[model samples]
Target chain A: MTGPHKERAVTHTRLDVLRLPLIGLLRRRWGRLALQIPLLAAAVLLVIDGFTGPQMAARNLATVAPWVHFRGFVVLVLLLAGNLFCMGCPFTLPRTLAKRLSIRGRRFPRRLRNKWVAIASLFLLFVTYEALDLWASPALTAWLIVAYFAASFVLEAVFTESAFCKYVCPLGTFNFVYSTISPTQIGIHDPEVCRACVGKECINGSYSPTPLVRLDDIPGGQCEVRHGPEGTPGCGTLLFAPQIESNLDCTMCLDCARACPHNNVGLFVRQPGRELLRPEAWPKRWDVSLLAISLAALGLVNAFGMVPPVYELQRALIKTLGIQSEWLMIGLIFGVGGLLLPFALALLAGALSRALARKKLSLRHTVAAFAPAFVPLGFGIWFAHYGFHFLIAPLTIIPVIQEFLGQPGDWAAFSSTADAVLIGLVQGAGLVLGFLWSLALANRTAARLYRRDAVPGLLPWALLLLALAFAAGYVFSLPMEMRGSLLMG
Target chain B: MSFFRLIAVGLLLLAAAGCRGQAITPTPAEKLSIEMAVEPDPARVGEAALIVTLTGANGQPVDGAKIGARGDMSHAGMAPVLAEAEGGQDGRYRIPFEWTMSGDWFVELTITLPDGSTMTQRFDVSVSGAGS
Candidate 1:
């Protein structure tokens, strides 16, 4: 704490900025449902409007809510706060219903209890969105929401654990990865308080009849005795308050805060993106590492799909390879450009890091340690693309909602800012900031790993990240083919 | 460099990208008025046509205007459909358009006057889910 004014830890102090008294409402048992109920109602309306109302994406609730507003807001909230999206997740309530009715189902298969499945699901989702043009189809978007709820119910009903949020659910997994960098997290007020407490109700729901504390649930969700009262629930994902290091798995459901008997767990604010720099922030697993890198790479592919160059690439590939199906070609791009190529780069970077540091650590550990450096850039690209839609068309949803409510909606109000220079510049700023954050994270991780050789070890990954940021910039600079009078070449 | 310095560099990059050049589209000096009639009275999904009555601000018919049309949904990312018009007598232009999906669409008319003067006008229309 003693340093020059410039070097003081004023900026780095892990003080609880968001104190317990500040978020008293959310710390209540049903606080989250107050938010979730409204969103669930909105989701239902979106589905109804998508299916039976106007089929136009812009005019329909399904297309506008999920694609534009939800996406933009999720990223914004994640970067600024934490996984607030999952706190009020509409699917969680329906999943809890399954938990209540199914009478404690069997445990999720041990072999299939990793991020690998979620990663695959996210990849498939990216491919489906582009190939099917899901963004433009309200019906399809509505169906997708319906499918998410159905999947949530079915998975929760069949599993003894909260398998859907932990091992499955691509959206949850995306939020989990990005949440690592968010500022606020569910944490204990004092370690001594947690150490002295016998009934760890944070992970174990506050059940009636002197509820039993399931200590086994504190680590890996093995303690599965779901006999809690109707109103009370704990960390459904089985994350202990005291042991929770990052926002990687916690859903930010505030259930932990509600369930903590000691009143110790609250939304404490910490440094954003600093969690990723922790030496043991993430487990040294290949699936976790690959998931982190893939999302970043896939976001680029997703953004590239909206630009004009992608169509030209598709046409060229079709002509040269005689590919008949458009979906198949796009799938190839996603699989190779999005998944495999980035993975290959990650492997090379891992190898070079080991070689430079003269360390013989396993490649899996090296890659896993460095994977977090990629998250910010991926989030940046996503923010840039989704934010563009949200910012450029801020008044778009008003007209759509009006039309949905049986009023004569003014489409003339559906005007864009038409300020390409300003919006593009904003997009560029977000992206570059993300890239810089990633670079800083990489350097810090390297320093932790290789000490004196940190500079050399981080070189390869730095280059790869720089290339990614450059690609993102180029795509942002290009005339993106969009609705209205945007990029109409 | 320190973390803060890197962020400062990123902001600088934004300032640089802000100065990036933009394409300037030239507009013809004419305040033309256009009255559009969708072929099927109320617009519906499927094969549709736009019959446009074009007139100059000088209160005369703009004859033999080369009319090109581009149509897109009100949202971003969908591929726009382009079409050319068939010129008729007395500044009337007929452009065939298809509402592939039932939704809100905006169609921009690229009007090339007989004297090679070019102008553009955009119209927003809602298509009912009635036709094929």
Candidate 2:
């Protein structure tokens, strides 16, 4: 109880991003829509190019933009900010429209409401991408975009309030998991304002009586009598600001900010991965734990597939197993890497953590509680992988754009030695930073759970993190196969 | 207005714009026309394929043609995989080559016609993984 270790209250400082004028602009009703329109237009153009333009993957917009630019920027933004891509997602626009048309609004099934569906979808996405060589087939990539739109439209048309984003959508899950370490998050400016408000407008949209209409007479309105119009709606995922803990389920749509009648919601800056340490704030669920660990494993798996060893391994498996279809072989690889291996590691770690903790916790609870700690390392691997592609061929987009515009241009002319070295260094630094952050989160979780005997609880998880870090480092060291890019073979 | 209603209107506009298809003009014909078919239908990585047939302007097999074939991943930075063949019987030149990896490979066939005019045509081939 002496020195700096003496028990004392720790004060947290937060910077309200809404205090800045630019955030005020983004919070407006049309703000997100304005940003989404251009993206939708780009999607439409990609589809057109995929269907009608040159079949060459390098020359097609569908193949280049999503695999190279979009994936790269998503990880970069998730690291720097919160889930900004989810905020401006164009796919949700159709869902919003379907809602307006009074499409049937049914609750998402309680049983299917966990992360299992998303996890399965994520695995399927990975397997399909590799099996079909989606990145090398512009037409298939284009159809994938169409499939996304159709799925969003159909899902939202039947269910109410962003079921596609919350319970489904692999990309959404990816963003949600990685954004645990994001520097920015939507938060309450003052908890007192939320306490006094009768209407939970942050989850349910704000409502007000129209000047001409009686409060009780407006049809389909929230008011007991009736209200003129349902004012601006709140969080699409039904997150209330005061109760919001982690970025786990949040899409960062900012509808919560728009629906706050008291202007109390604001985006705040805090220590990255702060939520992973706060187990009390989030519910410990088995599905989320599996999802987190699988994501971490899949991150390495995805990177591993591109290197030469995976090809050699696949060849060996083919010889040993006598499997004729490559899809089956790829599926076997995905099953081991994405599901079986990760689950085994999580089970072992959870067993150890339960054994060592001061308080008796269920194995599932212990695993779920500690799973968020793996996100930083998972995101680091992804960042390194996608960042390498982004850095080495940053200007690949220029020629792709030119080709899309019916102009002849050289997409292969963008690669160089110095750029590759610089990118490698940056990726290496990312891996190091990610590993350190994951270790810190693991330590924090251990200290919180085990108190005086934190070392025992921390040991197993630390080894897991170290292994993951080493795997990521080895992956980055390998010569990566840059699919769909002309600049990097 | 309900936020959904506003969004619905915006979606209508976007759908309209997205649905308006542009007329696709045909690309002008190239000076050299070469049709490449890999034997065994879908090519597999690490297996040899016989790429046969080279036709001239009149769509007939160009006899006595000197053909040089070079293959590489569509992406840059890798060393080129190459093969060459002169015209055999019926003006058909066969270049047997193997794909090192499973992905999109760009193959360039340079044909030196009987009249000494050289024409190069590039093609994209999808090579499947071994055991496919």
Candidate 3:
């Protein structure tokens, strides 16, 4: 097994984002707090608007900003950067203040540490959005924002670290899943420094009974050694820089960077989806596998909900089943599309792989190990769906701002046919790129697992990936409903 | 802290506070209520009749109002279908519009009252199969 130092030395080729002068500013003590203030203000406005503004979904800031603008931007950012939205999330700002007042520092429940709760939460979020027509209701969307704040505050006040972000938040789970492919990750600048250091400050924040003086107050702004009652802080997630693996649990809060006494932690740029290839970084677990598979299925379900065929299918099902409740119809569609379909596909792939490899691997273990291969295609579908909304009405934000100020402006001109075609091309490219990358990953996994004769093992997974990609490609080709903005009409 | 330092900190706090503007609540005089119905419920993907009954304060239907309506897909970037209707029997206004495609559509109505006050309301319309 490679030691932490060897891992660091090998991974040193990654560009250190903190080395940049601007990003380094975030390493300061108040850096995150400073960035959060404006976002918190925006959240406050959104909640207020939701309660007081016009009931129309498009005419209010409450609905447009979150559903239209925020969802679009989150996916785009995940594609390009690391989890920057989490870094700027305002939901946790209240928790920060509450912790300062009185913190119990309780640990999250041991039994509930897995991603099952989070996966369930994510599924519920998807179901509710469709069933309740959440995007069409400004007041409900506003309350969702309020509920997020309440949950974050209460959970963080009870627990010591970011329990909401790490264990419970559905949005965080979405970020965690998609961010597996993000190009940047927080890691150690030098593993040697961490190995020699006495205090592991990154995971544990610098603690003192009394308020510690800022290092800037001293002759030199930087401290050469750890001293005084104040101890350097550490990663809130308890991840040691040298041992930290993928972007799965990382919120990119940079607490580690600020807390490292030896200045070992730095945000590094690596190949996108590099973590998917590294099994050692994150051990294969049932929950994460289930999450990945569910995400893949939900990606299709999300896209299909917007297209014509699903609507037609729903109508046919309703007629045949004589289902009186529209909610039951929606429930059936989501259950089959999101849950049953993907689970069946994954089990089939695992069985095929086990049979082909001639190995004695447990079906569950094999499925868990190979589930990460589907992340790229899942992320591709999300990108295409959200990206379409973003590109088509990037300027929807303008009218929202105007309406908030009591001067509702005319809706901007609709995007040109050429623009729509260009977006479709980009979406197609995302699907193709994801397919190719997933194929490479599947092959690599096969080679690692089966050795010498990996091609036979790879074939089943390759076919599954191909089917997913083609389905996504077809969905992208269809005319989708752009539901969140008033600008369209 | 020095006077200048205090002022600087105060300015920073003020700037942060200014990020969110105050919420504006419409007064009773500014509030307009509207009720709408789309015929051929689950209006097929073609021409459908839209009936709107505009009301002012006290739940009274506002008669002699001029109405203009525009319909398009809920998502941005589609050509809009525009229609105009005059107030009819009992303050009911009727406008016939084509759905064009089967999906979620929003019909936005702008009503100009007899007093010349204009108010707007949006209705969500779901259209299914192609028209007969």
Best by DockQ: 3
What is the per-residue lDDT of model 1 for residues A296-392, given as tens digits with 9 covering 90 to 100? 9988888887666776687787789987775687788899988899999999999999999998889998999899999899899888888887776
Candidate 2 or 3, higher DockQ?
A: 3
Residue pairs with backbone overlap in model 1: A483-B76
List the candidates' TM-scores in order. 0.77, 0.79, 0.83
Q: For residues B7-122, could you state the per-residue lDDT of candidate 2 as single tens digits? A: 56556765664554443443433455677888667877775765667665687666777777766565423334567888656656677787765666788777777676777678
Please provide, for model 3 over A317-381, each residue's C-alpha lDDT reduced to its tens digit, 9 standing for 90 to 100: 86798775656777777778887788888889989988998877888788877888888888888
| Residue A152, model 1, lDDT | 88
Per-model lDDT: 0.76, 0.74, 0.74
Model 1 Cα lDDT, one tens digit per residue, B46-113: 78898888988988887777887867675642334567875667878788877654545777788887
Error of 2 at A6 (Å): 24
Q: Note the residue pairs that clash in candidate 2.
A: A216-A225, A216-A226
The worst-scoring run of ten residues by lDDT in candidate 2 chain A lies at A3-12
lDDT, model 3, position A145:
88
Q: What is the DockQ of each candidate?
A: 0.06, 0.11, 0.17
* lDDT top scorer: 1
